[model samples]
Target: MEAAIKFEAHEEVVSFDQEGNVVVNKESHMSKKLMARRAIEAHRERKRLESELEDYYFEEM
Candidate 1:
């Protein structure tokens, strides 16, 4: 047997199997936003690291 739950606040639907394992119906909006934010943060960190390395290389010259 399967059971489903809906969150009215976020309008997200979640399901569960008889064994109590969560089953995702679809990608949630919040998750998409979170992923985007994380991607942006990662890109910024990469750029910062690159800049620091370049500065250090120039200083050593």
Candidate 2:
């Protein structure tokens, strides 16, 4: 019988080397952390611009 594995959010057991480096499998797709960071930074920048625009227009006008 083959063992079964469960995948949680952002969890994929593709492969890892003994040195803890991620192993890439051409057959499998994996999630990456860079996308998350870029998303967060973009959200923050948007919020900052919106706040600044609101303050400038309402306060100056």
What lDDT does each candidate get? 0.58, 0.54
Q: lDDT tens string, model 2, 30-49? A: 34464445445655666699
By lDDT, the best candidate is 1
RMSD of each: 13.2, 11.9
The stretch of ten residues in a row with the least summed lDDT in candidate 2 is 1-10
Error of 1 at 14 (Å): 24
Candidate 2 residues lying further than 4 Å off, grouped into runs, are 1-31
List residue ranges in candidate 1 displaced over 4 A.
Answer: 1-30
Instruction: List model 1 lDDT by residue over 2-56, tens digit each.
Output: 2333353344335446864444535655576655565566556666997999999
Q: Could you tally the backbone clashes for each prediction?
A: 0, 0
Per-residue lDDT of 17 in model 2: 67
List of clashing residue pairs for candidate 2: none
